[model samples]
Target: MRRMTPARRILLLVAACVFLACTAVPAWRGAKIAYHLHTARYLLGQGELAQALSWLAYPLQEQPRSAEVHYLLGNTYRRQGNFDRALRHLAKARQYGWRREEVDLQVVLIDVQRGDVEAADPLLDRAAVHAVPDDVAVEVYEALAKGYLALHRIEDAMVVLDTWIQWQPRAVQPRLWRARIHERENDWDRAAAEYRQILSVKPDDVPALLGMAGALLARNEPVQALPYFRRCTELAPDPTQAQLGLAQCLRRLGRGAEAGQLIARLLRGSLTLEQQATAHYELGLLALADHRLHAAIRHLQTAVDLAPQHIALRDALAEALEKAGKSRQAASHRQQAERLRQQEDRISRLLAALAESPHNPDLRCDAGDALMQGGYPREAVRWYMNALKIDPEHRRAHESLARYYEAIDMPDLAAEHRQHATQAGAQPQLSKPDQPDGLRGDGPPPTPKACGPVQDQPPLQKLEQRAGPP
Candidate 1:
């Protein structure tokens, strides 16, 4: 080798220095990204989604080429239910390099929720063939199972849950999910077995207890269900369902006195129309068994009037009506029962919606209307009260509540509700005088009267108008 020139040596040294400078920048950039990502992950776990999004935005902007950054952004967006943003980021993640099974699984969840099963299947298949960390695998499997279940793809959901349980046998959620699938299929024995397995792991799991009790009851083993129902009532924040089930079991076991106590407790609380009807039906059955024909008829009539879709209760009521020597009334009730069948699905959907959005006053008020229409005045009042609890100044809730009170013969209470309605910004009926339209330059506003479908009553003319604007 010949000796190198000084100029060439200097050039080689400068080139080496430039290369290191370029390399060091990426390392420094990566460190900053890792810091933001760590904070974002912590925030995400704490359910501070907005904060997580803010922290994630930094890494996403600073390190676009980082696959982990894109994947995390996609995960966070998906968890926040922003499916479009999620898919955008997830697609970027896939485009930058290769497929991430967990990311693909999350994208598939969005597709499943969007009801694009065709789009979801290929991603799911890809995810199935990839290996992931166990923790990540658990989360992806759960998301897939829930997505499939929501779309009513029962067999797919069952397969996912089954696979998850096989890997982690003591996992409470998958067992509970498997139990629900069995319950939905009406395989009561299998559902009960799954619930028992879950209970063996997490003894105080309220959902499992409720499921087990329901399954046992469906199998006509009330004696075995009673303890589960009783324990469920004790553990639940809203004990109405468990209490009702416990009462039913007690009734079946010929412990009418204990059942009666539970039913009486339930009637005194806030109950939905179905719950109210169930309570009344049980009481009617107990009354019938005691040969108190008139009492039985009254309760059975109340139950049938409130929930005519309950064929079993209607059957009992029709029998009681016939036993009272009124075949014509029995026939009419049977006809009403037939007409009621289709309405149950709508009501059940509304009820389910309310359960998910219990704070929505509009939904609560609509539920009240449905119940009032179904002839459960008392239950309707409870739903109205629930609406008021969520939004004390809700105009429609107050108006409907006023009319309900008026119908129930509580005129004073009705008038008080009219006062609330007016205060809550309900417009008084356009004055009959019609001095032009809307908010006159006249001396004073018209007196507020009760709104909704109610008979005309004396207006609250003496009250002051504190409601400032339209």
Candidate 2:
């Protein structure tokens, strides 16, 4: 070999530097895209849809044809109930190397969510026949069951849950859900049997224990319920419900003093509004059993105030008031109770209509309106959320949520929904007429930041070195 000149050596060095640059830039770009994709997936799993959408935007802008990116973007949109955008991205995913088998299940889920179950049926039938991965099978089965229940197709929901159990006998969720359906039908014996099966598999399962106790109590077998409720109280982190059930059983078994003391202790602790109402109701029942009419009336009235929608509480309060010779007060409560019952009936009719026309946002809104009138604002929120899920731009739903969030003192969430309601072309009727629409007047809604701490990324130099100068 000839001895190379310094200039030639320098030329070779320059060429090597150019080659490294060429390889490194693409490698670094690919790594950045991958990082964004992985972060988006994590955010999606965390239920941070807004953050996930932001993260996905980067990879999508960089590699619009990337199959994984398109699939993930499709999922993000699907979760947001932007079904048109979801389907468009999913089509792109299929066009760019994602298999039809993997993509079809998601499409089925979208159809189910959109209340197009008939359109999803053929795809579901195909999925049932094929051997899919266990995770995929679980997701499909769960979605089908939920959709069926939403449509009030009880038999179909049962069939889906039964199939889920048959395929995955060891799975607890399907069995638990099956038991709940039985409970809903008032089949205490069947519910108890299902709970027993779960307890046999996982002896310390608090939900199963609570279910067994509730079923036995419904069957008027407090003797059988006591031990289960006791076990649940021992196992559950928040044993309020279990303790209440235990107290109920004790009172029924002629241990009213013990039950009253347990309830008194429970009332002194921190609890949700619902839990506090239940505790008060139990205490009222104990006082009533002891023939303390005034005490009973006070406790029951407090329960009625806390949970205004509970028919039983109103009736119980009226009963105590009547016993105390306050007939006028009792009559007023009874009339209010009747009005609530009628409103509930209206809500049920609207919900039944929704089952027939599952995608009807107006039906859902009507149900929410009825629930709100009946003083069930929390439950009404769920109905509004359901309406939004079917029709993202439903003005009434956004207006309802804005009012709810404002009442709860969540200004940021309230402002967001208010802005949405405004953009949907309706003037939102704020609960407080003087409340300012900050997002509306302040230019635009604030951008959502990515959730959690930022993860460190490898420098381009390190990534290039790892790729080794293609």
Candidate 3:
């Protein structure tokens, strides 16, 4: 071929350049998408959720219809606690060919968190009806159960939990939760049975041991519960609750001297306000058991001071003050108790009025509370069960029934109720109210309660604080 002219040569060069540009553009776009996707994942893993969201925005703009991108974006938003945004993205993902059980479960969670139980219910019902893959089905049911629990629909929670157990029998979480609900319902026997099941699966679970011990003690089998409490202490190494529990068991077994020694040791150490209060309370119990009235009064007084919210502690202090001829102080405590009792009664009456209308499951649960306060736990159980029969997914009913069982020394029944409670998605009970000690005291002690103990040590101070002070 002959040499081309300058103008022709320039045109040929331009054409070649244009072809290369076209090829490179698509490759560059693909590479950019991949980079952003990976960068978003990396940032998410690093806990930089905001940064991950920013990185996701670019790829979503380029590939707005991409299901995977939207799913990832939803996950990031969920992790950041932005349930609304997360639900929006997840809904979009589902709309774009990402219809799966996992996605449905996420939607359920978002709705539950947003307190839109009504919206979540249909989605859960649909997911269950559609028969998604096995793992997805399990997850979906679990999420639904949790949603019901959040709404305090305990019976509904139990049905879902039972479904989960049927699907995955070997899973321990469902069983553990069941036991907890039983504990809440005061079904000691049922709670014990569930705890036993947990112990069978994982022999060294401290929580299960503690729960079992508490159940046994509640059943007036302190001797039987002692070993479990000791085991809990052994496993926990430095568990204050376990220590206190062991001490209580020892006192019940007529080993008050040893229990008192343990209480003294606990008192001498630095402590959290809660621990301090508990230690003083235990010491008071030990002293009272031994008929050391003065010592008991001092310890009980310290406990009341440290935890003003503890009605039992205040009541005990009032009694001790009365015995010691401190009528004025006793009267003050008695007045406080009466006021609190009246307030509780007022709330119970209001709840009862609400329950008089048969349409509200929540109101029924609330009414059960009134019955329980009225010292009719068995009657409360009936109301709770009635609520559950009305709505098998009723959370409050399950919780109330579990507590009732525990109260009646039926651990197995308690466990069954607790299982449903967990399925209903009830939160773990953080603290239990201090119950009454069987003994009485006479006079106060000489020592002033210590304060400002080391952060990591046991408690010594007795600073009065509000209810649920810890």
TM-score of 2: 0.58
TM-score of 1: 0.50
Instruction: Give lDDT per model, in order.
Output: 0.72, 0.75, 0.68
> Which tens-of-lDDT digit does each residue in 1-470 have in candidate 3?
89899999999999999999999998999899999999998776544567798999989999999998998888778755577788888988989989676587676666653324445545544543343454334334444554555434455456555655654575566677788777766798999998888788878877788888989998989899999988988887456777877888888888888888887787777678888887888788776666677987899989978887577787877877787788999899988887667756664565445423333566667767776775556656656765664456576688778777787799999898789878767555332211112212332211111112123322222223222101
| Candidate 2 wrongly placed segments (more than 4 Å) | 1-132, 143-156, 356-362, 381-470
TM-score of each: 0.50, 0.58, 0.52
Q: How far off is residue 220 in model 1, in Å?
A: 2.0
Clashing pairs in 2: none
Q: Which digits, one per residue and each the tens of the lDDT, describe model 2 over residues 62-91?
A: 888889988888887876768899999999
How does residue 161 of candidate 1 score in lDDT?
Answer: 69
Which regions of candidate 3 deviate over 4 angstroms?
A: 1-107, 113-115, 129-139, 267-272, 338-470
Each prediction's RMSD over C-alphas, in Å, is 22.1, 17.4, 20.4
Give lDDT: candidate 1, residue 273: 97
